[model samples]
Target chain A: MFDNPERTNLEQLGEFGLIDHITKAVELKEPSTVKGIGDDAAVLDFSGKKMLVSTDLLLEGIHFDLRYVPLKHLGYKAVQVNLSDIYAMNGIASQITFSIGLSSKFPLEAVEEIYAGALLACQKYGVDLVGGDTSASVQGLVISVTSIGHADGEAVVYRSGAQVGDLICVSGDLGGAYVGLQLLEREKRIFLENPNIQPDLEGKDYIVERQLKPEARKDVVELLARLGIKPTAMIDISDGLASEILHICRASGKGCKLYEDKIPIDPMTYETAREFGIDPTVCALNGGEDYELLFTIRQADYEQVKGQPDISVIGHVTDADGGYELISKSGNVHPITAQGWNAFTSR
Target chain B: MFDNPERTNLEQLGEFGLIDHITKAVELKEPSTVKGIGDDAAVLDFSGKKMLVSTDLLLEGIHFDLRYVPLKHLGYKAVQVNLSDIYAMNGIASQITFSIGLSSKFPLEAVEEIYAGALLACQKYGVDLVGGDTSASVQGLVISVTSIGHADGEAVVYRSGAQVGDLICVSGDLGGAYVGLQLLEREKRIFLENPNIQPDLEGKDYIVERQLKPEARKDVVELLARLGIKPTAMIDISDGLASEILHICRASGKGCKLYEDKIPIDPMTYETAREFGIDPTVCALNGGEDYELLFTIRQADYEQVKGQPDISVIGHVTDADGGYELISKSGNVHPITAQGWNAFTSR
Candidate 1:
C-alpha cells in the first residue's frame, strides 16, 4: 500500500534468492539457537529444559481480510498468536520458524514489510527467527508460524491440572479484540459503499489496536512467577472466555462457576457492543481473539494475585457434578454452552 | 475420488470437532513427547540432546496437480519432505507438526484420508504427531509440516564442513523423481485430450512411485552411523545434484569436480529420460526432489564405502581457486552453473 514506484518482481529473484534477501537482516540473539537459517534445519540446544512447540496457520479470506489488515500487522499478529500458545504453557519462547506462500501479485517490497513486522515482534519478544519455507501460492497469501520455547519440567503448566476449589483468574480485559474487529468491519463496509468517505476510527484506537495488534500475555506468566504462584492450570483465550474455560473443565475433569459481572470488559468494548445491540456480557463470553491468559491457582495463593491491577478473579473450579454454570449479575444461574467462534462455520 | 457417497460436511463438525476427529487415533510412541495434541502446545523433552527444527510448505497447483496426486500420497509425501530435512542434518526426527488449510469442498472423509497417510508416515518413521493447526482456506489446499529432531551436539553434520580432498558421495540414485513427474504429466495430458483413451502407464511403476511416494533417507543416516563413518558434510538432493553441490561449495568456501560418468542414474530413469527425448545426464544434474542424501567423506574412509551398492562416490572437493567444474564422460571439463529447479521461476 506504500506509494513507491520501485517494485521488484519475485520471479526475477527465484525462491532461494528471496530466502536469502529475507534472512539477510535477521540477527539471532537466543542463546539456545545454535544455528539459524542456512542449513537443512536450525539447530537448537535447550540444555535439559522441557521444550514447547506450537503452530498457527493464517489464510487469506478465512483467517484475515487483507483489505483491513496491513501486511506488517498481519506478520506481527501471526507471530504473537503462536507465541501465545507457548505462554499459555508458562514457557518463554526462544525461536520461531515462519513459512509463507503468496501469489506473483505480491512484490518483493510487500514481502519485506511482512518480514519486517515479524522481525520486529521477534526483537520485542527476544525470539530468534530460525528457519522457514517460502513458496509461490496458487491464490491468496498464506502464512504458517511455528514457535519453540522452553521451561523447566516442573514449572511448565497444563490445562488439565486444575483441581477442585482452585480460583479461576483472567488477565487484562476480554471482548476488546472482538469488539475491535466489529468496528473495523463496519468501517470497511462504509468505505466500500462510499469511496469518498474515510474510516472514522479516531476515538476507537484502544479497541482497534486490540484487534489489530494483540500481544501474547507473556507478562502475566512472568507476573505469576514473580509472585511465587504456579498456576494449577492456564490457557490463552483465543476462542473466547467461555470456550477456553470449558476446555479447562473438560481437560481437568472439573466444573467451574463463572460470574458474568467479574468477566472484565473494557469500557470501549462494552459501549460498542451495546451500540451494536449486542449484550456486553455475551460479547465477553463468546467473542474470540482476546489473547488474554485464563488460569487457576490454589485458594491459598489467591491472596498473592488479589491486588494485582491486571489480574481479575472471575470464578472458581468445582467438582464435575456441579456442572458448568455462569452466575449473572441478577443472581440467575445459567448453564454455560460453548458458542465459541468457529472459523469454518463463520466462513 | 472416494467411492463412498456419504460425506460429513466440515462445517457441521466445526474446528474443534474436526480436530478431535482427526487426532482420535493418533497414538504417541515417542518417549520425548510429554504431551501430544489437545493442548495449546506440545511438550517435549530432549534431555541433553540438541534439537533440529525444519519446516516445508506445499501449495496446490504449484507443488502438485490434484488430477494425478492422491490425497493420501500428498499427505505422506508432505511429511516425508520435511523429515528429509532433519535427516539431511544427520538427526533422528522425533516429532512433527502438521498444519493444513482447505476449502469447504473437502469432506471429513477426505480430511481423514490425509491424516491417515500422515500418521502412517509418522508410524513408519517412529516419529510422533505432537501438534498442528487446521483452518479453512479460501481457495486450494495448503499443507505445512514442521519436523523436530535431535542429535548429539558433536554428531550433527552441516553443509559447510566439507574440506578439500574429501570425496563427495551420494546415497541411492538421482533424477528418478523428476522423470517420474514427467511421466505423470504426460499421462495427465493424454487423459485430458481424450476422454475414452486409457493412458499408458504400464511398466513405469518405479519412476511413478519415486515421484508420488518418495521416502526420506532415514535408513541411510542410520547406515552411516552403523558403518562408523561420520560425513564431513551432508545435504539432501532436493534441488538436483548440481545445485545441492554448489550449496556445499558456497557454504564451505570450496569448489568441487563432479564427474558426469560417476553420477548414478537408475536404469528405468535413464530409459524414461531417453523416451522423452531428454539427456539422462542433464536430468541427474538438474532434476529435483529425489530425496537422496549427498555427502562428503574423508578419502581414508573411501575403502569402507567402495563396495556399498547404494552409495556412489561421484566427485571430490577442491580449493576455491580450482572453480566448480564438471568432468564430462569425454574427459572435457565444463564450468558448472546452478540450474536447479526454481518453483517461482517455473511457475
Candidate 2:
C-alpha cells in the first residue's frame, strides 16, 4: 500500500534498529519528563498535581480504511483521540506513549512517516513522546496511545458533576467529521470502480479535514480558564453528541433537554448531510468523532461563555425524573436515545 | 474454538455493556487512585514522587497462538510483561490501563476470564486498573497494556548506569519459558497428527507454567531494597540474556564477561532442552520471555547479595575496549552475540 520511492524492508533494520531510527530525532520538550524513549520505563514528576491517564486503541479496517486514510493522518489522529480525553478532564497533557503493531507489508519509510506525524502532534501539543512498544502484527496496523496529563485536583471536571439548571454547551461545530467520513467512503467506492477517476474531494476541505485531522479542543479549555469558568460536567464528543450527553446525565443522575435548532452544525456539514439524503439534526445527534467538547456550566457562568463565538448553548440539565428529551424546531418533544455506533456490531 | 457450555456473543452486550460488565467487579485498592474508570480519564495522585510509565502491545498470531495459549493465561502474562518493565527500573507499579481489541469470535465468558486474570494480577501486585479502551478487531485478539509506577529518585535504576567494575547478577532461572514452549509445540504437532491421541504433558508442570504464566521479578526488587542493595544498572530479561546485557553495555558504554557455567538453568529446563536435542546454555542465552531481572551492582556490595539463593552472580563488567565475551566450561573464550528473537524477521 505504501507508494514511497525508497522501500527498505523491515527485517533489514530489525526492531531495535527501527526504533532507534524513528525516535532518534525525538527531543523531550516537557520538564516533567525526567527520562524518555531510551529507558525501560519513562520517568516523570507530576508533584503536587493530580495526574490524568487515558488510552485509545485504533484498529485498521474497523476504525479506518487504509485505502483512504493516509498513514500519517492515522498516526496523528490516534494521538489526538487520546489527548482529547485529557482535555475533557480539563487537564493539560504532558506526555504520551504510542505503541504500534503492523505486518511486514509496511516498509521502513511507511513506518517513519507514521512516527513523523506522531512527533509533529507531540511538538504542536507541547507533550513529550515517552516510552512505547513496537512489534510485528499478523495482519493490518494497530495503534494504541496512552496520554498522561496533570491538573489541580479541584479543577478537574467529571461527567458526574452536573447540577440541575446547568446550561449545556458545546464547542466549535458538530456533524462535520461524520459528514467528512461519508464523503471519503463514497469517493473510495468510486475510485475502486474506476481507478482512472481521481477522488472528487475538492471544495470539501473543511469537512474532509475534520475526518482526517481532527484536533482536540485545547483552545476551548484554555478559553474557559481565562474566563474563570469551570464546567460542572464535561466529555469529548467521540461517540456522537447524543451518546456523550447521555453519559453525563447517567453519571450525574440527572436528565437534559436538548434543542435541535441550537445544535451547532457548519454550513458545509448541513449541505453534505442533505446531499446524502440524511437529516442534518440526526447527523449532529448520532454521527461521532468530532472531538469537540460537550460540557455543563452553571447558569451564572453562561454570560461569560455566551459571548464567545465558538461556544454554543444547546440545552440545560434537568432532574433525573424529568428524563432526557429533545425539543425540535417545530416544538415537537421526543425522548433522546443513544444511537451511537457499537464497534462490535457496526463493523 | 471455544468449548464453553454457555457462550454470550460480544454483540449481545455491545461495547459499553461489555466494559461495565467486565469492570463492575474492579475494586480500587490503591490510595493514589483518585478516580478509576467511568470518566474521560482516570485521575491519579502521585504527589511528591516520580511516575514511571511503560507500554507493551501483543498481537495474537505474531506474539502468541491461541491454539496453545489459554485466554486467562494470555491476559495474565500481558500484564506481567508490562509490569516487569517497571520492576526493571526499580519502581513499584501502582496502576495499569489495559486496552483490548478482539473479534466477535470470542464469547463474553472468554473476555470475562481474561479480565479476571488481569484483575487477579492487579490484586496481587497492589496495582489498580484505572482506565482502558475496548474495541472490536477484524481478526484475532490484540492487547495493549500501559503500566505506571513510582520510585524514589535515588532508588530508581536505568540500563545506562553500569560502571566498569560492577558485577552482573540475574534473579531466578532462565530458558524454562523457551523449553516449555518447545514442549507445548511438540504436543500440538502430535495432536494435529492424530486427532484422538491424548498428548503427554505430565511431570512437566514447572516448565509448562513458566511458558504460560511467567511472573515479573517484584520480589527480587523487594529483596534488594530490604538488603540495602541498589543495582547501578537494571533491566528485565524479556529478550534473553545476551540481548539484554548487550543493551546495558551499549547504553552504559561498557562491556562484560559472561560465564556460561554460571548461567542458571532449571533442571527441568535443561532436561527438556537435552530431550529436544538443543543445548541448554544456548537456550539460556537466547530464549526470551523469562521475565527475570538482570542487574549490575558495585563489586564492594557483593557480600550482601552473595548468600541470596535466588540471585546468581554470573559475571563482571569491563571497559568498552574489553568487548563482550563469554567464558565456556572448557575455558575457551568467545564473543557474546545476541540471538534474541527479532519479531519482525523471525516469523
Candidate 3:
C-alpha cells in the first residue's frame, strides 16, 4: 500500500549511504544532547555527567556460528560488544537493555542460562539490567544490546581528533580472536565428520578465549583517566586493525603508519597461526573481532602511560599526504587496506 | 562442538521465572539511575528531568507476517512500539536507536524502505535518530528499537501510582487493530492457497490501517499537559486492554470497573468483527497492536479532558477490594480476565 522512491535500494547507496540518508532527516533539537549519530555512542546531558547511548545487534549464522560457539559466551559477548562502543567514548557503562529473539526450540532454562551469562557480564561491567523484550523467532536466536554510560562532558572523545605526529596505541593483544575462530572451525569439521572421534584442543587456549569471551578494553579507558592521559581520538578494534586505522585516518583527514613488529600478538596467537599455515601479521591486520581499543594520544601526554605493560604504541598519525602505510621489520612498506569483517560475503 | 541440555524437551519455568531468572545477578549502582528492570523503562536523572530508556524487538513470522504486511508499516510499527513504552512513562521521547537483521532474500531496496518508514516516524514524533548496528540473518527480518525520553521529575507517571476512585481513560478507539489482524490472517490463508486471489481489504480501510500503522500516543500526553492534568497511572495498550488493565491493577494494588457500552470501537472494526463472527466487545478488550495510551486520572480532572474527542474516559479505577469487573448494558457484572497476546502459538 505504500511505495516511496525517495528512499531506494540500501545497497545502491550501501551501508554508509543508508546511515547517511537516514541521519540527514534527524533534527537533534534537544539542548542536552551534545552529540548524536557520528560518535560511538549518542551523548546525552545528565546533570554534571553526560550519558552515552549505543546499540548493537548480532544474528545467528551471520555474526556467530552456533556449531563452535556456546550460548553463554554468545550472551556475554553480546553485552561486551555493545559495551565496547560506550568505552570508546571514554565512558563508563552504567545500564544496558537486551532484546532477544527467542526461537521455539530454545527452552526456558537454556535461555535463562544465556541470560545468566549476560547478567554476569552486567555485574562484571557494573551496568544495570534495564528493560528489553523477548519475542519468538523462526530461526536462530538474535540478541540486540543497548548500553548507556556516564562521563564528564569534557572527557568524552570522538573519532575525528587525531592530529599529525600523535601516537596510535592499542590495548592488550590483537588477531587472537580471528585465529581462535579458525581453530574452532577446524576442530568442528573434524568432530562433525566422525562423531566418535575426540578432537584435540590444546596449546590454543589464549586465542580460543579471545574468540569466546573477549573482554572490551574498559580497563584501558579507566587506566587512561588514572594516568592523567587523554586520547585525542579513540575507536574499538572490532573490524580488524586495518579497517579501524582507515576509519581514523579518513575521519581525521590524516594518514597513519603502523609498525608491523610493534603490533602486539600473543605467543599463543603466533604459534596457532603457524600451525594453521597463516601469517600472524596478516591475521592481526585483516582478521576482525579483537575488541581492543585503538586510539591516539598527544605526543607530550604519551610519557604518562608509556610505562604501562598492557598498552602498546604501534603507530603514529601522519599527514594526509603521507598515505596509509604499514612498515615491516625487514623495512618494506605496504599500503594498508580496509578489508574488515564483511557480513555480505556470507550471503 | 556445541551440544548439551538443549537437545530434548526443557520447559520447567514460566514467563515470570524467565524474567526473574534473567534479572537475578544484575546490579544497578549508578546514582542517576532511579529505577531499572522492575519498571517499564530504566529511569535516570537527566539533570532536573527524569529520563527513560526502553527497548523492544519485533521479529518476522512471530510479531508480524511478511506475507501480507508491507515493509514500510513494519518499520513504522517497530519504532512506534518503543515510543509507546516512552509514552507509557508520561515522558517526551528524545531519541531512538534502531538495530536490524535482514536475510539475503531481501534486496537492498527493502532495507532502505524500512529505514524510510523509520525516518518518517522520527520526523513525525520529533525524535532524533542516533546510533545502531545491522547484521545479516539467515531466515527472517528482526528489528530492535531503543527509545529514550525525558520528563520533569515530578510529572513522570508509573503504573504503581493509581488510586481508588480514579477515572480510567483511554486515548482513541480500540479493537480495530485486533479485527484488522484477523482480516489479514484470513486473507493470507486464501492467498497462500491460490496466489491469484486478491485480498479484499478495500472496505476495511480503517481497521487495516489500525493494524498496519499504529501510532504512539504523544498527542494524548501533550493534551494532558495543556489541560493541566497528570495521570495517576499510565500504560500503553500494545498487549490488549484487558491485559493492560490487569497490569495496572496488579501494580497499583487496586481493582477497576468498566462500562461495556462505553468501550470505544470504531464502526469499521465492529463490522469486521461481525463479518469474522467474533465478539466485538471481547476484541476491544483483548485485541492488541493498538498502540494507544491507557491512563487513570483523578475524578475531579475528568472535566478537564472530557471535551477532547480523541480522549475517551472509559471507566473509573475502583478500590482494592472492588475487583476487576465490567458492567454490561444489561446491568450484569462480569469479571474481566487477562488474555494477553502470546506469540508462542505459531499458527
User: Candidate 1, residues A55-152: lDDT per residue as tens digits?
Assistant: 99889998889989989999999999999999999999999999999987888999999999899999999999999999998779999999999999
TM-score of each: 0.99, 0.99, 0.87
Clash totals in order: 0, 0, 0
Error of 3 at B243 (Å): 0.1
RMSD of 1: 1.1
Candidates' C-alpha lDDT = 0.93, 0.93, 0.78
- Residue ranges of candidate 3 with Cα displaced over 4 Å: A1-45, B1-47
Interface RMSD values for all candidates: 1.0, 0.9, 12.3
What are the per-residue Cα lDDT tens digits for candidate 1 across B1-347?
Answer: 44457888889999999999999989999999999998899999999899999999899998889899989999999999999999999999999999999887888988998899899999999999999999988889999999999999998999999999999999999999999999999989989999687868799999999999999999999999988899999999988998999999999999999999999999999999999999988888898899999999999999889989999999999999999999999999999888976767744
User: Which of 2 and 3 is the better model by lDDT?
Assistant: 2
Off by over 4 Å in 1: A2-4, B2-4
- Docking quality (DockQ) for each candidate: 0.86, 0.86, 0.17
After superposition, the stretches of candidate 2 with alpha carbons farther than 4 Å from their true spots are: A1-5, B1-5
Q: Extract clashing residue pairs from model 2.
A: none
Better of 2 and 3 by DockQ: 2
- What would the per-residue lDDT of candidate 2 be over residues A1-347, giving only the tens digit for each residue? 46666788898889988899988978998989999999899999987799999999999989988899888988889889899999999999999999999888899988987888898889999989998999999878999999999999899999999999999999999999999999999999999999999999999999999999999999999999999999999999998999999999999999999999999999999999999999988988999999999999999998899789999999999999999999999999989999998988954
Model 3: clashing residue pairs? Answer: none
